[model samples]
Target: MAADPPPPAEIPPAGPSSAATARAGTTPVHRLLPVIVPALAVGVASALVLLGISLLAEKLQDVLWGTVPDALSIGRHSSLWTIVVLTACGLVVGLLVRMVRGHADPDPATTGLVDPPLAPGVVPGLLLVTVLTLAGGISLGPENPITAANIALTCWLGRRFAPGTTAELWISLAAAGTIGALFGTPVAAALILSETLASHPGPGALWDRLFGPLAAGTAGALTMTLLAHPSFDLSLPPYTHPHWGDLLSSVVIALAGAVLGLTAVYAFPYAHRFFRALKHPVPALALGGLLLGLLGALGGHLTLFKGLDEVRVLAADPSGWSAGQFAVMAVVKTAALLIAATCGFRGGRIFPAVFVGVALGLCAHALFPSVPVALAVTCAVLGVLLAITRQGWLSLFTAAVLVGGAAVLPILCIASLPVWLLVTGRPQMQLHEDGTPLR
Candidate 1:
């Protein structure tokens, strides 16, 4: 849930933190304490900040849906209301960014599970617009912007209160904390950070390096759990035994998902170009909203919004949807994600991507009822995330965590190898140009 500005903020953990890192010859204890002492503090701060923004947005969304749509006498899920409401959201967001100073619009490309920290001053505008984005069913999530905001906030807090802590340390912790808050598990943050930490050179052991962020993630996850808990468990049937057929089918279905996701990756640049072609936020966003409304009309309300809840709905009763309907839902959701991101909407892509992948998985399962539904969904998620983000472990985590069972792990591991080879060198979904560039 980001989209703050141009040139994408470089996430702090891209490497080691200069500010709070261990000295070249320091003892292990020195590194450990430095991180441990401030771990809880950063995590709590991240949770509190995220909790406040989330509560504010949820209440605002309730009002928008409960009163505004009803008061307008337009059906909440009706085509007309979807069109008018989304178009209005675009207009208001565009005008705010245009007319207001510090409205905080970053490069939409980098607003996702990972993004560089933003300044605290930008927090207010971002919070304001992100709330509006969520309320208006903009096909985005709150992860990116909130993560960025927390990074900036933690950085500032570290410098002010804990003068000894490095900005990078705080940035990483804040990011970890936000991930915990978003996914309701510290594991999500830890898994995503594995690649980052593996490449880093430091004085401590790898686990030692991870200590602070993990601690922070645990705290943040707990805070979110107690306040507004979220779970990826879709209540699907447990896979008891691994069949030989499941392995082959998993590969096939997952590869199909990868192919599907690559379509969006290839289309992403073109979509961003088309929206920015207008060279004006007002018309661009308004038109994007209109297109999304058309999609919503076709796919229904289940396809709208960030998709966390919608994914559950699809999973709870996969057999209810015909194969064609599942296909429509996946395609429409992906298109909406592209439009919302390329246009001026503020949010992240991971949550929506997960939802789209689930739809694709469901479609595959429906097409071939012989394949285990959980297996298809798991592998499909792995494939799509691999193409979209090009991060293998994170993709593995999404697939593994969503199924909520260890029985699928061995098959997923084998499936990931071919999928990894297919997506190893693909270009990421990030845009290189914010404005018009040579096509």
Candidate 2:
């Protein structure tokens, strides 16, 4: 009104100082406090949910593999029973997928460790199929579905209560929580998330970005450890001395494992296309189960399911089997993993991949007898995981964890270099809906 109001004092956009002040306002404690509580809740919830589903699956597995067979006076894990149960499982899963909402999630082949939050309506069917897969001795694991379910639940609830928080935060917290529970360690969550979260743009240090996830991981890990008492160490003879020969053997075995895993990777898209050609879940999954049953019969019971216990069994008596037996087991497991993954099974490949690595490593040890068992196993595991998962840190961590020693670490680090080169830029095991490699 009066003299144009002095043209209004010109206000400047936020400069470096203002931005710094804004950043300062969100101090580590201040930023962490808001999400930490929710993160802890998510972590505990994720662990409990994982444990519940696992326990349920175990009970079902006991009935299917033990009680039913025992009552019927049939040999447990016999070939006939294996075929019957697997085929029945396929029919059940197929019926569920055909009848249930969300169809138990898109073909498992198209999913990965971390995916966008699924609809709440989809979670129950996903969980049911996951349970059936686990109990039915499917060659996959519970990681993908459990993680997906937790993420869905977390995001669904978080958005209702804390509308301001980003969906990414919920995803990180849920994934970290589930991974911690699954691996029984927050360190695994940190390692896995470091690879996934590195490129995410944010206004904080790496640790700052990891704060909520680490908290969730810690809670989930503690919950799982206290409840389940899981252990990854195989109690293999420790490797105390590092020699030139061991290094040479490690590199050689690791490269061989990489090549074997690459063969599967190359075959994955074709296998998926072959299954998808059927164009219906029922026949595709039923036929897949029949094939898995045949594989279980051929590989004995060791090649069935997600393979954690089978791996321990193999590790318990690495020398009990002939090199030929080990070779057959490794090859059968690789094929089983390929079939389970491509043919509409709802599980993870990592556990079965671990089994493959252990079998391959033992095969190497059985053949040579001079190489250290720990070194062979670690290197083989590193190579296989590197080729299949394409995760360097995880490959190294899993390899080191299985052996439970620092002595093999340097060798594994060195061995991974060449193996990494072999697998770099290769097509991943995952595929698109159109059956193209996900890469």
The TM-score values for the models, in the order shown, are 0.91, 0.94
How far is 61's C-alpha from truth in model 1 (Å)? Answer: 2.3
Most TM-score-accurate candidate: 2
For residues 1-439, write the lDDT of model 1, one tens digit per residue.
3222333222232223454343467555654665665777778778888888777877877777667878887787888888777888888888776665465656566455555567778877877888888878889888778888888778887778867555667777888898887878888888877677665554456676677788889999998899887788877777768999998998988898888888887788788888778887778888888888888888888888899889999999999999999989988988898889888787888878888889988898899988888888889888888888777877888788888999998998999889888876675677654432211
State the local distance difference test value for candidate 1: 0.78
Which run of 10 residues does model 2 get worst, by summed lDDT? 5-14
Question: Model 2, 1-439: lDDT tens per residue?
Answer: 2211111111111111223326645555665666678878889999999999999999999999999999999988999999888888887888898888999887788788887788989999999999999999988889999998998999899888877666677888899899999999999988888886654444556787777888899899999999999888988999988998887899999998999898999999898889889988899889989999999999999999898888899999988999999999999989989988998988888888888999999999999999999998889988898888888888899889998889889999999999988999889888766677755
Give candidate 2's error at residue 71 in angstroms.
Answer: 1.6
Identify the runs in model 1 with alpha carbons over 4 angstroms from their true place: 1-25, 110-112, 434-439
Each candidate: RMSD to true structure? 3.5, 8.5
